[model samples]
Target: MKLTKREKLFERIENHLRITARQLVKFDTEEETLQYLIDSSRSELKCDFVGIVLKEGNYLISKVWSGSCVSISESFPIKIENCSPTFLNKSITFDKVDKDTICEFSKLLLEENILTWFTVPLKDDTNTYGFCIIGFMNYVPLLDEMNRVFEEFGKDVAVAISLSRRKEVQKNKMMGVEWISQNLTLDTEMDQIVGKLVERAGKGTNAQFACIYLYNERENCFILQTPAYGEKTRLNKILIEKNYVLKEYFPYLETPGGPQLTVPLVIDLKTIGVLHVENKGSLVFTKEDEEILELLSNHVAAMLENARLYNNEKDHKQRLHHLLDYQQALVKETVEKDTFDGIVFTLSRLFSKTVMIFDRFMRPISYELFDVAEDELHTLMELATFEVYQKKNRDLWFSVDYDRNMGVWSVNGGSDLLGYLAIDITGEEIDDFFKLSIDLARNIASIQFIKQKIVLDAKEQVKDSFITKLLVEKIEDEESIIQYANLFNWNLFHQHRVAVLSIDLLEEGTKDNILEHQAKKSLLWDQIKTRVLFYDQDILFANKEGEFILIIPIEKEKEKPKVYWAKLYEEIKKWLALEGDKSKILIGISGKTEVINDYFIMYQQAVQALNVVSHRFSNVGFAMFEELGSYTLLHHLKDSSIATLFIQKHLEPLLKYSEGKSMDLFHTLRVYLNNNGSIKETSDELYIHRSSLLYRLEKIESLLEVSLNFAEHRFDLMMAYKLYDLYYSNTALT
Candidate 1:
């Protein structure tokens, strides 16, 4: 098409707009660039009423008006859709509009008598937001040269908007990168980092208020740590769930009472927590600001993660060192009968806490204090046990109410609890010093447990050795044995019974100084004599090589011989197990012999029975001479063949059936006899149904060809079973 003068003029204006866009890219701020575009366009496109009416929806608002026109608000609405086809397409147009189209533009436009208009759409690479309309009050002919200039001007205007947007984006991206770099350089201490972030971000964005809500993994919640306001700031530690709702469009948005922008602190696409910047004013946050904050949050999250790891590692190292030192101290000292006070003193010095050591029974053994009073200390100890030690959970460091005034950080070592260490951190720094100290306390508690075990084992060894030596050396004199027992601080003056047990030790060296010292210091044997004698007198009291002899005295006349023997045997076994050794113990009782002179014969008998039972049975436990009957004398005689013949003839069926796994026939026989042949009682005792017990009895009757229902037969069979057991059991020992 042949171009008119007016078309030529529009073309020149379009080219000028593009040049202006390129120039606008150099400016940093949005307002400065926008103003530059308006001034440049008006001066270049010299004409009356050369006002740049920046599009405001369906109405045009004059941003820069050149000639005389009534002052119109910058935000006046204009209906550009109906005004020009070119404006709707976000293109440039020189349209001759009639009164009908003018009226359609807007009611305000009609009232202002806007007849003709030229419009250029202001757009970037994206959709055009609005158009730049130039209104002419009177109609003018479209001269060919003018048409060219106007067309060129429209193109320039499009180029200007595109370049301006590009520059703004580039500037924002650069600033974002800088902000992230600075954020990462912040320290790992969360409060310090949060403080720095809030200060820098608030000033940079000109925000009224700012806060950094850090994620507390333990609580599984976000805590607002750094508030721009003072300590009384209502925003600190606000939970995300209590305050904000998460959304895909914008995770942060303005709420009912405030303008809030929350960006998730994300690392590796995982959202750790949210960072919130809020203002009470009506200032709307821009998209660019949100992006920048998001970028900053990313750096903050990564730094926080690193800081947490660093703190954990440092604490672990400190704990390891404390444990090593504690273990060394325990190994060097004798801790057999350490009081709770001694334990507390040791541990408190280790971790710098007021520590209390409790046994599994929840009794305080030792405690150490700084400024706390005795009653307060006792109360704190009880509180610690109730709060942390009794609980099944293994929370290492927690808070405990201290006299209702302050809360102390307590570290617990869980049930069968090794007690707790409470530090008065009322005035300490909230950093590595506090965390490391708590960790060290836990380590010391663990070491204390190990030390206690070691001390107990040592005491047991000394007692075992003392009894074994007295028995093997034939020191059967009660006075000599009593004197030897005195070496372990066991009193023999009280009414007592001597028990001898032989246990094969695991190691070559039987002498343990810790055990010996514990034996000398223990009050367990204070009122009663406990002498542990060994088998080989020449063997240098090695815990590994020989049998142990135990002498236990009962101070009470009411104590039964069998009952005391069983209790003593169990106690020894438990002590042995704690030593972590596999030494089978064969225990023998001398009955409840009270006379000091009789202890010699009783000791020989007990030792003899121990040897007999250990040699006869694969698993030997406590054996009493009084219960052995004739076998006690028979065991000393060594008549193996005669004893075997008697067992094979009378108890053959019971033995064979028991060996063949037929209802544990031996055990059934023993229980049946023990219940005095009462079928109902035996069944109840064995937890077996009555019918099953009857069947077993009937089977035994048939096998033995004896009617156990008769009193005479029952008596004969019971005696025979007892005799057979005695003969074989004793003969095996010989």
Candidate 2:
């Protein structure tokens, strides 16, 4: 009555076949059928566990499990890292899984003490659903008879899973449609509607992350109508547009991390936006998820259309009237030359709250204090700046953890994000009238800011033109220069010095890098203008030839112009975080010139001084025209022989004797002259003993027939050494 191993397997296979055929037909859903398969298969194989895993987009997700497990659950996703679907789909055998090259999920089972497993691809004629897996508590061979039973089960389960997913799709679609139908109202903001859509879609479709993006034509970026991804705590502090590029609708591609599913929201024949989702727990996206996503996207489009039609029909005239009324009030206030603070104060009184105004760059320009506490105002400003950095787009929305009583809105003109207005409604209530007044105030403020910016820009342009002409030696006369200068409200007829801020940013010269460099220049310009203590002396700033030129008038109480210039240089270096040794920053200053016509000479001197920093004097960083001692003489000398003559007159004998040598004599002479004939210092400079340096200096002095101690002799020798290094580039020294 004892049965053989082959006979026992045969009986077991027959029983499993019978169970799958009968139960698969009777089960109402894929989940129910999968539970039955898991239970029946585990019993037939006497395995520890039976589970069904199917490919969902880029991940393998568990659908159902029967037996106990330790390491993993249904929530765990089989991440496809080492192997891709292309490799698995082309496996030689559908039933036998190569243990060495098993998927990540199989490895997890082995780690949990399930040493052996047999998985069959759950596939029909055209589609592979996933894998139907049975794990063992002990080692077992993958046999032919096992595949026969599991293959039948896979075919049946594939059908069940396909049908079950269709139901899931229908359920999700119906929910989205129902939600849209109930929420479509005349006054619903598109931003609010999109936020709800993302929330519901992520939950309903069981996605790890979801997003609703609308193409902001003005920004040339995809605006997140909802949270870009995940909860606020887990959201990436990076721009979403950088992660996802906008392609034509329905384009499928792989991201740097993995695959993503994109569902285009189209209205009529035009694609308006995108709905994107990635991962479902540990599982990839499924056909059901994609269908549901697309269906929801369609509903979103429909909702948008409905809202647009509603606004056009019902609120068009009212909106126009409100805008008109806002414009009239702004006109009345501005015609009276209301200051920025005055405007802010009016808005605060209208809303019966504190208000703060920021420029386009997020620098607070004005505010209405009106009983606001100092500590509270300070905290609000700090929080506002932090939130501004977190914004992916320029539009303002009071969506952070700041006070909900605060009403934050953008002051936009056309597509430009002009500025922002934040109203503190801490203890007050906001009605429709308050909201309307705020909208008008922000619009008026933006207009006023732009107007002021235009005037400043015009003045800057005039200043730049005048400076450029003066620097290029194109000024016809002092009168013309003064007339051009008067248009900018700047007095040029004062003793002034020129300072050149020279920065060479070494990076790959890409277009994006160029744009970034330009932005830095703009920011640095703004910072310099804001922080430079003008001190009753006017500063004219200009950008030319990839550098900044500052024509600063001399203060009446200054001691020496060079000391003041060097101090200013150090201050700028510290503020920009560009120390002399670590970063590439060279500042040059020209000596003071009294006449307006003589400023061109000072500008030339500053340019020459900055140029000398790259070529001469090892200790030079902050250079002045007066400090460039030998460089000025050497630079003006056009005759090469004249430079050679000076070198020969001072130390011709040493230069001749040092030829074909290590330039030891030239090195000894230069170091000796630099240390003012101090044998010990010269020894330190050359890393030689003092006695050796004294002996070398004696030999050199004997050869040149000059005393190294005399000031004129040392000066001539130093000039000769410097000139040799500059013109010959160490050829004559060697």
Candidate 3:
């Protein structure tokens, strides 16, 4: 243009800026754009070196530089606050290299043979990005116009840097949106989503490191996704804390390397995971970057939560379908086949666990074992008792051992407990699915029990009617008796004893309400029946008001009748003790008989023996008619007036003579007869001196007119005393 030097310089700066602008459009990154500006400035501004240091956070980091002083400029990193005033906002020119007169920025420039140089603040109207320093090796005059032109060029550089950054930020934002739309979805696998999420977050935000930590509810810890690129120690610290606020940079997260930002993937106000990015290129994380990640995190949380719900729903549907199939199988097998074995097999197949059904007495009635050893099954069955099963409520699980847990539900038929439905769980945590399935199975089992109970109850009515006629001598026809007995698979022609069992509450036990009392009685009777049946299947039984009458056939064995009864008595007692509560169980047995007609008399004898134990023995465990010995006569004559008159005639006089006396004459007579009339033995038994016992005996003989020295008189007195002891153990002397 043939203008003055000032105009020419200004014109050259404009041309260079135009060229840089065109080049800026070609480059994409901030580094590329800044490098072009530095290169153009060094070539057109006639400088030995040019470098641009931008303010990033609180420091002025060298972004790009060109020319001969590259090593020196690259080494002299600058903090904005630590820079000398000469290298700050205003342009400063130096005539020559003078280390003593200048700041470190100029001193470093002079060391590279730069005698004349100036710095211009690369600033827009709003703020300063940083300063651009231009150094010349040879001397050059700092013309005001050239300085002004360079300053304008510096402003152009700041605008270009700002535009490039805006482009990068916009591009990253779009990339994040596209990635979220494409990858984070219900269709995506969680592993794939999380892995790509961390990598994409780091790349999109211009951060060197990124991580995604998913929370595990079961373990109550965070699980780091695979292939994570980040400071795991710092990420782990945040995870351990678990107390970070959403979408915020913790003050303590700031480090010498860079600042860190964490945004939790929250849903329903609960943090399911977190999106963490650190070292976002040389700058602190901006609110926009955080917002972008926050949006992405929120979407991820929603997707994760939705996917979880979807999967749970799918699982629930499958579980319901399985439970329905199990129920149908149970109904079909238990109702159509009329067996509990099907129930056990079905449940075992459904749950892949061991299944056992126990009758009301805790005896295993039906079982299907799966992957269980014989010894372990025995141990498990042993653990399954009314006592232990009752300790936990129905349909709930309790640990039976370290590796096994058990759940039991009572199969109830109306007011009676039919059985228990039990399942053995090994090495698995119980969930609602199992509980629901077991509950359904128990219901089906209970229904089947009720049906069986209905049929059995009809049979019981007929048996009870037949037994009543037999016991009351109503069925005198032997053919009718044999026919009825044979119907139940019983051989009544054999010699059998009638054992009348009476169960009552212990005197010391708390009195229960009527229903509770009956329930306990029913439970106790079930236990007794199970034990007795195990002993002998031919045992026939019928329930009366408060007792159970059994027709127990006497087997022809070497063991005596008393010994057999004793063993049976002990077995019943063991069953009672298994309840872990106390009760009175009294059994009265009649003498063995072969005649069917004599069954009535034998039943009477059993009743009499039971009465003796109830009244004379305070309801002791058991008594037998044959074991009663002399008491059998009393049992027969117990209701006779002659028996009463005999006891009165023998002991009434002694009772009258011993009135108000410290030494009882009637007691002395009893002791004298019990000791075989031996004076010393009688004295020892009475715990008295021989003379004192003789005096009482003489008084008794005088009152009753009995000779103590004669055997005939002693025999009469012994009979009288035996009668007295039998009828008058308590106060009433019948």
TM-scores for all predictions: 0.49, 0.41, 0.70
The TM-score between candidate 2 and the true structure equals 0.41
* Alpha-carbon deviation at 359 in model 2, angstroms: 3.8
Best by lDDT: 3
Q: Which residue pairs show collisions in model 3?
A: none
lDDT of 3 by residue, 1-734 (tens): 46887777767777886677667656667888878777877777777888777676666667777787776666645555556645556566675334465665665665677677777777777667788877777887777756666677667666777777777767766777787887777766666776788877777567788887767676556666665765554544334445544334344131223477777788999888777788765566655567667767866888877776776788899889988987888888866866788878888898888888887767787889887776776676666773445664445455667767877777777666778877877765667877677778778888877777677677777877778878875556778878988889887778888888878766433354777777778767867776777677778877654557888877832358777777887888877786575777777789877777778878877876776666545435788887877778666673667766888888878776678988788877776776778899988878999888877877777788878898888777777766665555435664
For 1-734, candidate 2 gives per-residue lDDT tens digits of: 99998888788787767767666766556777788778877777788877777665556667777787835665456655643453334322323446667765655665687667666677878788777666777777666655566666667777777666666566666766787778755478766776777776677657767777666554455555555456532222223344454444324421212345677778898766777776664445555666777777777786766665676656666756765765676677766763677677666766667789876545677887766677667766766766665763554445224444555677877776667788776655454655766777877887787777677678667777778777765567767778887875767767778878766544455336778877766666655554463323366778765568887777732877657766776666675563122334676678787777677778867776766554454255667777778766665677878888887777678767887986468667866766777777778878888777778878888988888778888888877766665456424433
Q: What is the lDDT of residue 331 in candidate 1?
A: 38
CA RMSD of each candidate after superposition: 12.7, 24.2, 6.8
List candidate 1 segments past 4 Å from native. 1-30, 36-105, 108-129, 132-154, 168-483, 500-550, 559-596, 604-734
| Whole-model alpha-carbon lDDT for candidate 3 | 0.72
1-734 in candidate 1: lDDT tens per residue? Answer: 99987667666766776677568667765556657766776577544455455543234445555553454433344445544544544434345444365444344445666565565555545545455556567665444444444444445555555565556667766766776575545345656666777775666555677776666755556666654532233344544455445553234542222255777777887766666665634344555567657656755678866766676777678767866777566434434534445545665676565665554433455666766677776666566656553443554333445433222333334433444445554454456655654565556566656566567568667756555554453444557666666766656555555665454444444436657544432322321122122211211122313333345545432456666555655665664564344555676666655544555566666656665465444365867776766656655546657655655655677767777574876678777876888888998888999999888888888887877768887666665555555444444322
Leading candidate by TM-score? 3
Worst 10 residues of 3 by lDDT: 248-257
Q: Residue 431 lDDT in model 3?
A: 73
